[model samples]
Target: MKKVLFATTALIATAGMAAAEVKISGYGRFGLDWNEANDVAGALDNTDATNITSRFRLTFDVSTETDGGVTVGGRIRAQAENRDGAQGRATFSSPQFHVAYGGLRVNVGNIWGAIDSAPGLYLNTTSVGTGIDGMGFNSLAIKGAGFDTFTSAGVGRGGIEAIYSAGGFTGHVSYSKQNGTAGTSTDANGVERTALMLNYSFGDYFVTGAYQSADNGRTITKGGVAVEADDDVIFLAGGADFGQFGATLQLAQTEEADSVTLAGEAEVGAASTVIAWVNSTDIDTGVTAGQTVTDGTAFGINYEYDLGGGVTFVAGYVNTAADDNDNSVQAGLHFSF
Candidate 1:
C-alpha cells in the first residue's frame, strides 16, 4: 500500500480543516484455468478446455479526521479482468462514503449489505474461495438468494448501512431500493430489501446470525406461470480456531432452498496453507409438476504458498453440484500492494 498526505491549508483555510490522506492499494492475479464443462462437444462448445485468466484492481481510499475525532472517508476502485477468451475494459466503480465515531459507523452509496458482511459467511482463503475467481463461489452456504456486496465496477447496489461494534459484539443493518414502479400489487416492478446481522466473538470462537426480507421481488414459476412474491432469508454460522487449524459451519434457509456448508483451514508449514469446504443444498424448483425438488453436493480444495513480499502461488480444484457433475482446476500467482 502507498499513502499520500495533502495539506489542504490553501483550500480549507477558512473552514479550519485538517490534512487529508489518500491510500492506494490493490492486487493482480493471473493463472491457467481448466474446466470440464467447457470441453464438451457439439453446439455448446465455445470455450477451450484450458484458458488464461487474469485480473487487475486498483483501489483509492481517502480519509480525514475532524477536530472532534470523527473520521470521514470514501473508497473507489478501478478494475479489469479477462476470462476464457473475453477481456473486459478497465472500469471505475461507484464510490462508497462513510462517517465513523468510535465504534459506530454509517455508510451511504455502494453500501455493503448486512448479510454479505456477516462473519463466517465466506471461507478463510486469500481469494475468499477456491481458484483465482472463486470458481463461481459454489462453496458458499447461501444459494439462490440475492445479496449486496462490494462492487468493483459499475453503479453497484445503491444502499445505506450502519455498523456498530463494541466489546465482542457487532451489529449491521442495511436497506436498498431499486429504481422501478413500486407497489404491493403482484405487478410491481421495483424491489426493496432490508437486512440485519449480528455477531459475537469470544476468545477463538464466534457466532453469527443474519436475516433479510425482500418486498414483492422474488420470482417463482407455478404451472408455467411466472409470479412475483416476497422472499425472506435466514443465515446462521459459527466458527472456532485452534492454533494453526480452524473450522466454520454455516446454515442458510430461504423460501426456495436450504443449504449447509462446512469449511476448514490449516497451516501446513511456515509458508504454506490449505483450505477446503463442502456444501449441500436442497432446492425447490417452484414448479408444481416435474422436478419439484432437487438436492446436490459440491466441494473444493485450495492451496497457497507464500513467496514473501505480497506474492503467493495458488492452486485449487472444485467439483460442482450440477447434474453433469462438472469440475475445474486452476493454478496461478497472486500479488498485492
Candidate 2:
C-alpha cells in the first residue's frame, strides 16, 4: 500500500510540473542626446541639450499543445519611458498584446506593425529629420500619413489583419479605418480615412506597397473660397539581405509632392551601421522650398552594443543637406527586456 501511494504522488507531481510555465522579463536604460541644425525648419534645439531618458518593457507569455497537433499561445507587453522629468511623461509604449496558432498570428491588440523591422527591434537611424530614432520602427511622420498600406509602426488605432507563413515564404494583408474632428485632417481636409497595404517576404527578400486616401476640406473666406481639400498618398519599399548586410529603398508620393529614401545597413560583431539618403520635391521639382530639399540628401550611421541582461548602448549620427542645406547630430542609449 505504501509503495502504491508513493507512485501515485510522483505521477501527480510530474503532471503538475508539465501543465504550466511562466516567464517574467524587463529592461530599462537612460542617456543624453544633442542636435544642431543649420537652415532646417522644425529641427530640435539640441544645442546645450543634456538629459536622461529611459525605456522599460515587460512581457508575459504561455503556450501549450493539445493532444492533437494544435498549439496556442498568447503574450502581453507594457513599455514605459522617462526623461529626467524634463519631458514630463512616463507613457507606457510598445506592442501590448500578441497571439499565435499554427501558421497564423493574430495581433488582437496594441502591437508592432507586421511590416516594421530593424536590426535589433530597436530604432531607425535613417532619416536625418524624422527617422525612427535608433530605438523603434520607421519615421512616424512618414508612416503615419493616413495610409492603410504599411501595417502602422505601432498600434492598430483599431483594426484587423491576417498573415500566413509556410516554409520560407510569407504573405500578409490588412485593413483599417480612422476618423477625427474638424481642422485636423492629416492626409486630406476632414477626418474620415481608410488604408490598405499588402506585402510578401521570402528567404532574405521583401517587397511592400500601400495606398491611403483621406477626406479633407478647407474654408475659403472670400469670393469662391474653396471649402474642402482632398489628398492621397502612395508608398512603396523593397529590400533584400545578403548574410552580413541588407538594403532597402522607399518612395512616397502624394497629390501635392513626392519623396524618396535609400537605406542600407551592415552587421559587425555586436554593432551595426545604417545609411540613408532622401530627396523631396514638390509637384514641380524646380520650385524650391527654400534651402530645403527640392533635391536633398541625408545620411546616418549607428553602433549598438548589448550589455547583457537587457541593456543596450546605441550611438548614431545624421547629416542632411538640400541646395541651401541643413546639417544636424543625434545620439542616445536605450534598454528593454
Candidate 3:
C-alpha cells in the first residue's frame, strides 16, 4: 500500500498525467543455523551448532513518469538480519535513484556494484545465504587478471551506473570512487571500482559475462605500494530453462585462483554447489601459499511449498570448508507481503 505524501502529488498526477506511485515489499525468514566460521586458521576449530539466523527486509519503490514519457524512480531498503544469535538492529541502505528513457537507464547513489548486480554472473540458491559460503568463494573472486576484491566494499559516497537493454541483449557499466579523507588524496587508503557486464538471452537459453577491476592499491610516502592489477576478477554464467526445470553454471577466475558454481531448480525445490581452489598458490588469495589448496566444496539445497497468501515453507543448507568443514541447515516459514 502507498500513501500520497502531499496534495500536490495527487494534483500533479491528475493535471500532468504523471505516475507517482510508491510500493512496499519484502520478505522474512527465520530458522536454525550451525555456523563454525572464523577468521584465522579455524578449520580444525569446533564451535557450537544449534544457532539462530533470520532476515527481514523491506523495500520502498517510489516512481513517477512525466507526461513527456521520462520515468524517474528510486528505492529505499530497510533490513534486519541475524547470524548465530547476534540479532542487530534494523538498518537502512542509502537510497538509489534511476532515470530511464526507453531501454537505457542511469542510476545514482547507492547503486549495487556491477559484479554484484550483473545478471547471469552468479547462480541462484533457494535458501537464504550470506555471500560468504562453503566453497570459500563468492562472486567477487573473479577479478580477471587482478588479485584483490572490492565488489563488496563498503558503501562509499555513492556511485554512478548505467544499464541498457535491447532485444535479447543487456549491458551494464558502473564506477565507484571512495577517495579517502577530506581533500584529493588518491594515494590514501581508498577504493576505485569499475565493472562492465553483458548478458544475452536466446529462447530458453542465456549467457552472461563480466570484467571487473578495482584499485585498492594504497601507497605510502616512505614505505611502498601494493601491486596494481592484483585484484582483477572475471565471471561467466550460462543456463537453460526447460519449463519445469532450470539449470545454470557459473565460473569465476582471478589471477591467483578460480571457482565454479552450479545451480538447478524445479517448481518446488532447488540445489546449488560451489567448488573453489588454488593451483600453485603464487599469490595470497585464500589458501596456503605454495601449497596445493582445495579451499572447500560447498553445497546448498532447499525445498519450498507455497501456502498461499504470499507465504511458504522453506528448508535448506549451506556448507563450506577451510581448515575444517562446517555447514548450516535451516527450516522456516518465509513470507512476502
Candidate 4:
C-alpha cells in the first residue's frame, strides 16, 4: 500500500482542520481455470473446459484525525473481473464510512457483517480460499449463507456495524435492512439482518463465534429461481499455530443445514507454502423436500510460491461435493502494491 498526503491548505486555513491522508492499494490476478463440470453434456455443457479468469482492483482509503482524537475515514474500491469467458465492466463501489476512537470503531454503508469478519472463517488461500478467485469458496462453512463482506462494486449491503478490540478479545455487531418488492411471507424480498461476532486469543490459539438472524428471510437465487432464505445461522471456529504449521476448524449451522471445515497451512522452505481444507455439509432433506439439495464433502489444496515484491505464483485444485463430484484446477499470478 502507498500513502499520499492531501493538500488541505484551504481546509486548514478556513476550517482549522488537519490535513487528510489517502492510501491507495489493491491487487491484480489472472489465471487459467479448468472445471470438469463445464465439460459435461446438455444445458450445462461447455466445449472448452479451461478458460481465463482475471480481476483488477483498486481501493482508495481516505481518513483524517480530529482534534478530539477521533479518526474518520471512508473506503471505496473500483474493480473488474472476468470469469470463464464473461467479462464484467469496471465499476466503483459505494463508500463505507467509519469513525474510530481508542479500540472502538463504527462503520456505516457497505458494512462488513460480523460473521464475515470473524477470524478463522476463511482458509488461508491466495484469495482466501482454493484459487485466485476462491474456486467458488466451497470450503467455507457458510458457503450458502447470505453474509456481507467488503464489496468491490455496486451498493453492497447497506448496513451499520461496530467493532471493538482490546488485548486479545474482539467483538463486532452489524445490522442491515433490504426492502425489495413486497410479496408473500415465504417469498418476500424485504429482509432485516442482525449479526454478532466475538473472538478471543491466547498464546498461539484463537477461537471465534458468530451468529446471524434474518427476519423475513433474505432472498437468494438457487437453480435460477428465487427461494426462501435461511432464517438464522451460527458459526464457530478455532485455530492454532505450531511453528510453521497452522490449522483451523470451523463449523456452521443454519436453519436447514450444517457444515464443517478443517483447514491447514504449512510453510515449505522459505518462499513456499501449502494450504488445504476439507468441508462437509449435511442438509435436512425434509426441509428441502422439493429442492435439489444433497449432502456431500468437498476438498481442495492450494500452493503458493513467493517471488518477493508483493508477487506470488499460485496454483490450486478442488474436488466438489456435487452429485457429479466435479473438480477444478487453477494456476495464476497474484501481485499487490
Candidate 5:
C-alpha cells in the first residue's frame, strides 16, 4: 500500500514540475488455436485448444531530455493473460515499473531481461510462432508452462537490467533472482539467470552475437542433492540487403549439455519468412537416455503490410514437432501511437 502510494505520488510530482509528458498506451489481441498431438507429452495434451484467447498490455510513461544529450525516463506496465480472467482488476501477477538514465537502465519491481538480439524480450508474440520452428532463437518455445520470464509468475524476486549502446557496437547484460512468497519456501532459493550480447552493424550488412547463462538450483532438497545447473548459449547472426530482395541467416548453439537452435529469415517484397530447427538433449548429467529427448523442428512464414501511419499488420503460422507432438496457429496487429 505504501509503495504504490509513493509511486503514484512521484508520477504526480513529475506532472506538476518542468515539462512533464505523460503518455498512456496499451494493446489487445485475441486468437483461436487448434492443436494436434501424436505423442502427447505436455499438459495441454493433443486436444484442440479452440477458444478465444487474448492478452492485454497497459503502459504508462513519463520522459524528458536534457540539452547535453542526456535523457531520463520512467515506465509502469501491466499485462493480463486470458482477457476473460481479469480485464480491469488489479492483479499482483503482472506489475512492472522502472526508471532509466541515458544508457543506464535501473529496474525495480518485476522485469524481464533482453539479451538475444533477434529474440530479446519478444519471445511470446502471437506472430512469433511456436517452439523452435517459428522464430527460432527468438521463440519462447523453451519457457516452462505457466512460467513468465520476468518474475517467474511472481514466485521469485524482482528482475534488473543494464544496457549500453554506442556507435556501431551495442552491449546489454541482465540478471534476475527469484525468491518465493512471504510464507512458503517453495521457490525459496529461486533461480539466477543472466545474458550478455554484443552487436555491430555496417552499411547494408549487420551482424550480432550473444551469450546467455543460467544457474537453476536454490530450491533443491537436502541429502546434498544438487539440482543446480548451468548452460552456455551462443548466437551468431548476419543479414544483407540488395535493392528489393534481402536475406538473413542466424545460427545459435548451446553446450550440447543443453540445446541448439538454428534459424533463417528472408524478406521478399513486403513479406518475410522464417525457417528454424532445434535439438535439445538434456545432459542426463544422471537422468536416462530415450528420456533425454533431442529431435525438434519448426517451420513458419509471415507477411507484413505497412499502413503508412505508424501502424502495421503482421500474421504468421508455424508447425512445431518434437518429443511431445504440439502445434499452434497465431496472428496479430501492431500499432504505435
Candidate 6:
C-alpha cells in the first residue's frame, strides 16, 4: 500500500513534466480453455478448464531527453502467470532501454528479435489465438502457435535491437547471446539469434517479411523434450481491413539441414517432437546424433471486429504445426487500455 501510494504520487508529479514523461498501462482477460488429444491412439487425452483465465501486467514507461534533441526511454513491466496464478510480488519482466532520433532507434536489454516483433508475423488480437498463450491444444501443433519468437533466455544474457522508419516503411533487427552450455539436451551452453524484418503499410493493407537464424538454439517442451540446434526460419504475413472487419494470413518455413546440433524430445510412442509441437519424427531420431528438422510449413489466419472503447471481438483458427495438420479455435472479447 505504501509503495502504491508513493508510485501514484510520483506519477502525478511527473504528469506535467515536458522533457520527461511517465505512464502506466497493461491488460486483463478471462475465458475458457479446451484442449484435445492430437492422436486418439496416444495416451494423452482431452482436457478442459472453465471460467479461470486471467493475467495482469503493469508497465512503467519512462522517457527523457538531453538538450541535443536525442531522446532516451525505457520500459519496466511486471507480468503474472497467465491463468489463475499468483505472484508473491511483481515480477518485473522484459525491461528495455532505448535511444531515439527522428526515425531511428536503438534498443538493448530484454529485447525481442526482429521475427518476434515483425508486423503481420502475428495477429494483434487480444486473445492472439484460440489457445490462451498457446499452452493449450494449440501445443499439439509443431509451431506451438502464434508468430512468437520469444527467447526464454531473457536477460539471463542480454540483447540488442534496432528499429527504423521512413514514411510507410519500417525495419527491425536484433541479436542476442546466451551464456552456459547444455548437457545432452537441456539449455544450450550458448544461444545466439539474428533477425531482420521489414514492414510497409499502405492504404488499408499492410505487408511484412522477416528472416531469423536461431543459433545455438535451445527449446524444451511440456512433455519434457529438449533440442539444441541452429534454426533458419523465414516468415511472410499481411493483413487488411475493409470497414469493420479485419483479416490476416501468414506463412512460415524452417530450413532443413543436417545436424551440427542435436534434437531431443519425449518419444510419445515412436513420435519425437522436434521443438515444441513444431516438428516430429515417427521413428526415434536417437538420443544422440539425431538429425532433426522443421521443414514443411506453418500458417495462421484470424479475424477481428472493433467494438471500440478499447474493446474488440476476436476469433481465430490456427494450424499450430502445419505438418501435423494440428488446429484449434478460439473466440473472445479483448480489452486494451
List TM-scores for all candidates, in order: 0.89, 0.61, 0.74, 0.89, 0.66, 0.65
Model 5 misplaced stretches (Cα beyond 4 Å) = 1-16, 38-49, 64-70, 83-109, 112-126, 130-157, 186-188, 216-230, 255-294, 305-314, 323-325, 331-337
The digit string of per-residue lDDT tens for model 2 on 1-337 reads 5335544554566684645334455555555544343224664454233345455556555455566745555555555655432544433332334345678765544433333321112224332223224422222213213333222233333445556677754555443344444576555522334444566677788777655555543222222333212235566777778877777777766543466666666777755454443333434233232211133444555566656654455665555433433343345555553
Task: Write model 3 residue lDDT over 1-337, tens digit each, in one string.
Answer: 3234543455565675555776677778776665545323544343455556677878778778888888999877887877655545677777788999999999888776667665544444323233222122332234224322222123433679888999999898888766577776745766777888899999999998887777764321211324444246778888888877777777776644566666676663332232222211123353323223245555555566667776766655555433464555566666776
If the candidates were sorted by their TM-score against the true structure, best first, what order would they fall in? 4, 1, 3, 5, 6, 2
lDDT, candidate 4, 1-337, per-residue tens: 1332232432444464457776777899999999887777663543468889999998888888998999999999999998876756788898999999999999999898899999998887669988888998888887455777778768777889999999999999999876564453555555678999999999999999999878666445545555555456899999999989999999998655689999999999999999999999897554533333347998999999999999999999999888783889999999997
Which regions of candidate 4 are displaced past 4 Å? 1-17, 43-47, 181-189, 218-228, 289-293
Estimate, for each residue in 1-337, the C-alpha lDDT of model 5 and write its tens digit.
5335645666687775665455666665554444444224564443334434455566766666666645566656666654212233333244555555555665555555544334322332233544212323223323211121453233333666666666666776767766655777654466666777677777777787666676763222223443323345556666665655555555554332333344344444664333333333333334222122244455555555555554545555555545344455545455444
Clashes of each: 0, 18, 20, 0, 4, 8
Q: Name the candidate, 1 or 5, with the larger TM-score value.
A: 1
Candidate 1 colliding pairs: none
Candidate 5 TM-score to native: 0.66
lDDT of 6 by residue, 173-255 (tens): 88887666445656445677787899999998888887777655544332234443345566676767664345555565443
| Superior by TM-score: candidate 2 or candidate 6 | 6
Off by over 4 Å in 3: 1-19, 36-47, 125-157, 181-189, 217-225, 228-230, 268-294
Instruction: Indicate the residue-level lDDT of 149 in model 6.
Output: 42
Clashing residue pairs for model 5: 133-298, 156-179, 157-178, 157-179
Location of the lowest summed lDDT over 10 successive residues in candidate 6: 258-267
RMSD of each: 3.9, 8.8, 6.2, 4.1, 7.1, 10.5
Alpha-carbon lDDT, every model: 0.83, 0.46, 0.60, 0.83, 0.48, 0.53
Scanning candidate 3 in windows of ten residues, the lowest lDDT window is 273-282
lDDT by residue for model 1 over 197-275, one digit each (tens)? 9999999999999998886566766557654333578999999999899999999987667899999999998999999
